[model samples]
Target chain A: MNIGIVGLGLIGGSLGLELYTHRQQTQAQISNNPSASPSPSYRILGISLEQKICDIAVKRGVVDEASVDLSLMSQADIIFICTPIAAIAPTVAKLIPYLQPHTILTDVGSVKKPIVENCSALWPNFVGGHPMAGNTQTGINAAQHHLFVNKPYVITPTANTPLESIKIVESIVDLLQAKIYHCQPEEHDRAVAWISHLPVIVSGSLIASLRQEDNPDVALLAHYFASSGFRDTSRVGGGNPELGLMMAKYNRDALLRSLQSYRQTLDKITTYIEQEDWQTLEKQLHQNHSDRLKFNL
Target chain B: MNIGIVGLGLIGGSLGLELYTHRQQTQAQISNNPSASPSPSYRILGISLEQKICDIAVKRGVVDEASVDLSLMSQADIIFICTPIAAIAPTVAKLIPYLQPHTILTDVGSVKKPIVENCSALWPNFVGGHPMAGNTQTGINAAQHHLFVNKPYVITPTANTPLESIKIVESIVDLLQAKIYHCQPEEHDRAVAWISHLPVIVSGSLIASLRQEDNPDVALLAHYFASSGFRDTSRVGGGNPELGLMMAKYNRDALLRSLQSYRQTLDKITTYIEQEDWQTLEKQLHQNHSDRLKFNL
Candidate 1:
C-alpha cells in the first residue's frame, strides 16, 4: 500500500513520520509472526511544492520517497491533502488526475462542511478528515513524531461517501495514534465553531480592546501586571492570522452565531456588574465554572 | 525588626515562608562578616485566627513565632495583612490598636484602590501593595517559599502616604525578590481591569455561552471537539467564583468600562465576519497578535 501526503507543513510532515514508523513496525511484526499477513505492506510518499521541504522530509526519514511533482501521488493508494482551509479545494482539484481508480483521498483541514461538499462531489473516494492538532509554530521545522498522539481526529463523511473510504481513513488515524470521531460535515463544522473557531474571535477581540486603551501609562502598567490569566485567554486569539481568517470565512454562519451568543453572555455579565447584583453574578460564575468542568477535553 | 503576616492563606503563608528564609539568610551573612551591619536583624511573627494554622506555620519553619492574639503584633515593625479583599479593611481595623508608632502596614490584594482608600484612611502607616503572583490552589497547604520571586509587586501610594511607609514596603518587596512598580491605587485598579479582570469575564462568558447551546448533540459534540484552545481561553473564567466576584465588586467601574470596550471590539469583529470582509478580519487578528507580543510578561 502506498500512502501519499501533500503540503509537508506541520500536520503533513508529522503524519508522514508517524505513518512511516507504523508501517515499518507492522512489517517487522508480520515478519516475526508466521500467522501475520504480510501482503499489505505500506510505504509513505510525500509531496511538496517547495523542493526544500521535500528534501527535508526525505532527509529526516519522514517518508520513504518525496518529490515536488503531483504525478508522484498517482501510485498512492491513499492520499491526505494537508493544506490550509482556503487551499484544500484547489490542491485537491490539481491532484484529481493523479488519483488512481483505487485511490482514497482525505484532508486535514480545520473546517469540514465546505471542503466535504466540494471534494466529495468531485471525487468518489474523497473523505473530509480534520486532525484536531496544531502547534504555536508552523512548517516542517515544527513537525515532530507523535504530534497527533491521543488528539481528536474528526472524519466528516457525507451520505455519498463510501464505507471503504472511511475505514481506510480510520486505519490512517490509528497509524497516527489519534482518537477517531465520526460526524456529518455540517455537525462537525458547528461543533468546531463552538469549541475552536469561536475562541479565536473572542480571544482576538480582547487584545484588540486592550490596544484601544488611550492612556499610555495605563497600557504600560497593564503590561507589567498581566499574568497567567491574560496570557492563557489571549493565546488562541493572537495565533495564526491567516488560519483565523480562513476559519471565519469557511465557517461563517456558525462562527457568527457563536460570537452573537458570546455577546449576549457578555451583556448579561456586564449588566450584573452594573446593577451590583453580587448574588446573581456569583451564581452565574458558579454555573460557568461547573459547565466548564463537565468537559474535561 | 519584626515582620508580621496575618491570615495563613496562600499569599500570607507563602510570604511567611519567604520572609523567614530571607531573614535567616541576612542574619547569617551579617554573622559571617564582621564588617556587615547587624543592627537591622529581623524576625517573622505570623498571626492567624485559627490556632491550627499558627501551629503549622511554626512547625514548618514558615515563621520565627506564631500566635492567635492580636497583641503579639505589637512587636511587628512591619505587618502584611494578607487576607481576602472583603476582610482586609476589617482585619486592619482590628490590628490598629496593636500597631506600634513605627510600624508599616500593607496588604496583598488583587484590587488595590478600594482597599488602599479604606485602609490608608484608618491607619497612618498603611501602604497598598499587590504582589502579582498566585496559583489556582488556595490556603496554607498551597503556600511555598519563593512564590513571589521575580514577580511584579505593585505598590500604590497616594499623595497623603508618608515616604517612610512607602520606603518600608519597598524594602519588604525587595526581600521577597520581587520587582516593585509604584503607581496610584486607581491606576493599578484600572490597569488590572484591562489585563487581568477583563480576561476572567470574557473567559467565563465563553463557557457560559457554550452551556446555553440548546441542541444537545451540538453540546455533546462540542465537548468532544473542544481542545487546547477552549481550555486555555476558559481557564480564568472557570476559576474561583468568589475571587471573580470580589474582583467585580471591588473594581466595579473599571471592570464595567473594560466589559464595554470588549463588547464593542467583539461587535466590530462579528460585523466583519457577517459582512464577509476577510481582509479586515485578518488585519484585526494580525493587530491583536502583534499587540500580545509587545508584552512578554
Candidate 2:
C-alpha cells in the first residue's frame, strides 16, 4: 500500500518513521512465524516544500520516496496531511485535485473543526485526526518512530464521513499502536481548546507578565529563581510563535470560550487570595489536584 | 561542627544527605592529601513530627542522629528550619528557646518576607534562605542527595540581618555546590511570587476550568486528549494543596501583585484574540519565547 505524508516536520516525519517501522516489523514477524499471513507492503511518499528535509527523510529511511510535487500523492492509497493548522485547508485544496476518489485522507493538526469542515466539503474520503503527542522540540531532527506509541489518536468524523474511510484511518492508528478516540469535529475542537490551546495562553501570559515587570532587579532575580515549575508551566507558551498563532487563529471562538472560562476560575482564585480565605482556596486547589489526577494522560 | 535540620521532607531530607556526602568527601580529601588543612568533624541532627520519618532518615544515612526533641537542636552550630511557610515562624519561635546564641538559623520556605521578619525579630543569627529546587514529589521517601546541586539557592537578608549569619549560610550553599543569589526579603518574595506562586494559580485554574465544563463528553475527551503540554503546565497546580495554600497566605500581597500583573497580560492577549490581531499576538508570543530562553534554568 502506498501512503503519502505531506509537510515532513515533527508530526509528518514521525508518522513516516512509525509507518516504516511497522512495515519492517510486520515483514519480520511474517518471516519468523511461517503460520502468520503475509502483511501488505508499505511505500511512504513524503511531500514537503523543503526539498532538503524531503531528502533527509528519504536518507533516514523515514520515507520510501521524497517529492516536492503533490501530484505524486495520486498513487497513494491513503494520505496524511501533517501541515500546520492554518495551512491544512489550503494544502487539502491543493491536494484534492491530485487525489484518487478511493484515496483515504486524514490530518495530524491540533485543531480539527476547520480542517474537517474544509476537507469534508472537498473530499468525502477525509477523516480528521489529531495525535495527542508532541514535545518542545520540532522539525525532522526531533522526529522518532515511537512518537505516536501509546498516545491518544483522536478521529473526528462528521456524518458525511464514509465508514470505509474511518476504518482505513483506524487501521493506520492501530499500526501506530495509538489508542483511538472517536468524536465529532466540534467536540474535538472544544476539548483541544481546553487542554491544548488554553495552556499556551496561560503559559504565554505568565512569561509575558514577567516581561512587564517594572523592577529590573526583581525581573532579573525571577529569571534566576525560575525552576522546574516555571519551566514546565511556560513550556508550551514559549513554543513556535507561528504554531501558537495558528492555533489561536484556527480555533479562535473555542479558544476564546476557554479563556473566558479560565478567567472566571482565575478570578475566583484571586478573590480567595484577596479575601484571605485560605480554606476555600485550599479546597479549590485540592479539587483541581484530584481532577488533574483523573487525566492520567 | 554540628548541623540541625527540622522537617525532614524533600528539602530537609535532601539537605541532610547533601551535608552527609560533603562531610564524607571532605574527610576523604583530608586523608588523601596531607598538604590540605583538616576540616572540622561534622554531625547532622534531624528533627521531624513523624518518628518513622526520623528513623528512616537515620537508616538512610541522611542524618547522624534523629530526634523528636526540639531541645536536641541546642547543640547545633547552625539549624535549617525547613518547614512550610506557615510553620516557619512558629517553628522558629519554638526553637528560639532551645537554640544557642551562636547557632545560625536558616530556612527553606518558599516565601521569605514573613519568615525573615519573624526570624530576624526573634533570632539575630537567622538568615532567610530559599533553595529553588523541588520536584512534584514530596516527603522523605522522595528525598535524594544532590537535589541542590547547580540549583539556585537564594539568601534574602534584611538590613538588620548579621553579616556573620549570611556567611554561615553561604558556606553551606557552597558545600551543596548550589549557586547563591543575594536579595532583600521583599525582592525575594516578589521574584518568587512571579516564578513560583503565580504558576500554581495559573495551572490550578486551568484544571479547575475543565471541571466546570458543561459538556461531560468534552470534559471526558479532554482527559484522554490532555497531552504533555497540559501535563507540564498543570504540574505544580496539582501539587500539595496545603503547600499551595501556605504560599498564597504568607506571600499573599506579593502574589496579589503578581496576579494583577498576570491578569493584565492575559487581558491584552485576549484583546488581541478578540480583535483578530494574530500578528500582534504572534509578536507577543515570540517575545515570550525569547525571554523564556534567557532563563535557561
Candidate with maximal TM-score:
1
lDDT of each: 0.89, 0.89
Per-residue error (Å), model 2, residue A260: 0.5
TM-score of each: 0.95, 0.90
The collision pairs in model 1 are: none
lDDT of 2 by residue, B31-133 (tens): 8997777765889999999889999999998999999889889899999998777788899889988887788999998888888888889887889998988
Output the TM-score of candidate 2: 0.90
Output DockQ, candidate 2: 0.79
Candidate 1 per-residue C-alpha lDDT over B1-297 given as tens digits, one digit per residue, 9 for 90 to 100? 788999888999998888777777777888899788764467889988899999999988788888999899999989999989999999989988888888889999989888988998889678999999989888888889889999999999898888988998898789889989999888899999998999999999999999778788888889987889999999999999998999999999999988889898999999899999888888898898899899784
Give the residue spans of candidate 2 off by over 4 A: A1-3, A20-35, A38-46, A50-67, A73-77, A99-101, A134-143, B1-10, B24-35, B41-67, B73-77, B96-103, B136-143
Displacement of the residue A106 alpha carbon in candidate 1, Å: 1.7
